[model samples]
Target: MSQIPPPRRRRALGCGIAATAVALVGIVPTAIVFVLASAMDPNYGWLLFITLPIAVFFGSVALVLGVIGIAFALTDRGGYAWPIVGIALGAAQLIPAAALLTG
Candidate 1:
């Protein structure tokens, strides 16, 4: 006799909440910093132009992740992948900014 497969587990998207919060909190600071940097150094400001989009994208992803996570959790389904995506996009935003500072 063939055995039946087990049901898939539903994981939570913890990163989603954190990412949304981070984005909400980070937006102003980032904008301010970007403006200041631009005022001080146009080249650095340009980096902000590039990095800001990533941050916004990630922030939006995070919001979506949070919503999807909640919805899936309520429906008893798995939908935690969004958090990972949020984190990835968030990091994408940070990478260039960090690199600018480091390099």
Candidate 2:
């Protein structure tokens, strides 16, 4: 008799999705604000205050979670697209943060 196949696991997909969402939250709004404000004023240096906390604190979380989630996804045969996106976004957040420090 033929046996049924096991169900595909998605145990870590939620983690991946959450990582992506958090990364987005840390960066997208800040980007939108700068993009909008740059058109009106040449100086918006104070916004670095907002970027610093999110980048230093939450960006690291998203990066670590994304890596862990991707590993879990691979082992569990879950989709990894979100985790990859999350990692990229998390890493991207560091650029502006480093710029803030130096410039």
Candidate 3:
């Protein structure tokens, strides 16, 4: 017989997926902006101010969601593969944004 998953497991999984999606949404646009900025003339450098803030905002959101997802996943007996993935993706989003801001 197949075993059914618990409610908490489902919630954790949902949160994990949401976090991963958020991170991807944050990263993709920033990547595109970065590439475009690099390819274009130096005069448009001012655009970084606009794109960077948006990317940072999304990155922060992803990080928060990923942390919450990880916390929820850790409380259950089920595997936390998705939450781990979410955390990784969230970090991926944050690192580039931080680097852009700092550098």
Q: What C-alpha lDDT do the candidate models reach, one value each?
A: 0.60, 0.79, 0.72
User: In model 3, where do residues sit more than 4 Å from their true spots?
Assistant: 1-8, 39-45, 96-103
Best by TM-score: 2
Per lDDT, the best of the predicted structures is 2
Q: Give the per-residue Cα lDDT of candidate 2 at 17.
A: 83
- Which has the better TM-score: candidate 2, or candidate 3? 2
Backbone collisions counted per model: 0, 0, 0
69: Cα error in model 3, Å = 1.1
For candidate 2, the lDDT comes to 0.79
Find the 10 residues in a row with the least total lDDT in model 2: 40-49
Q: Least accurate stretch of 10 residues (summed lDDT) in model 3?
A: 5-14
Among residues 3 or more apart in sequence or in different chains, the pairs in candidate 3 whose N, CA or C atoms overlap within 3 Å are none
Residue-by-residue lDDT tens digits, candidate 2, 1-103: 9999988777578778888888888887677668766886657657757766766666778898899889999899878888888888888887766887799
Order of the predicted models by lDDT, top scorer first: 2, 3, 1
Candidate 3 C-alpha error for residue 16, in Å: 0.8
Report how far off residue 16 is in candidate 1 (Å): 4.3
Of the two candidates 1 and 3, the one with more favorable TM-score, higher being better, is 3
**What is the C-alpha lDDT profile of model 1 across 46-80, one tens digit per residue?**
56565566566656656566665666556665565
Instruction: Give all TM-scores, in the order shown.
Output: 0.39, 0.77, 0.70
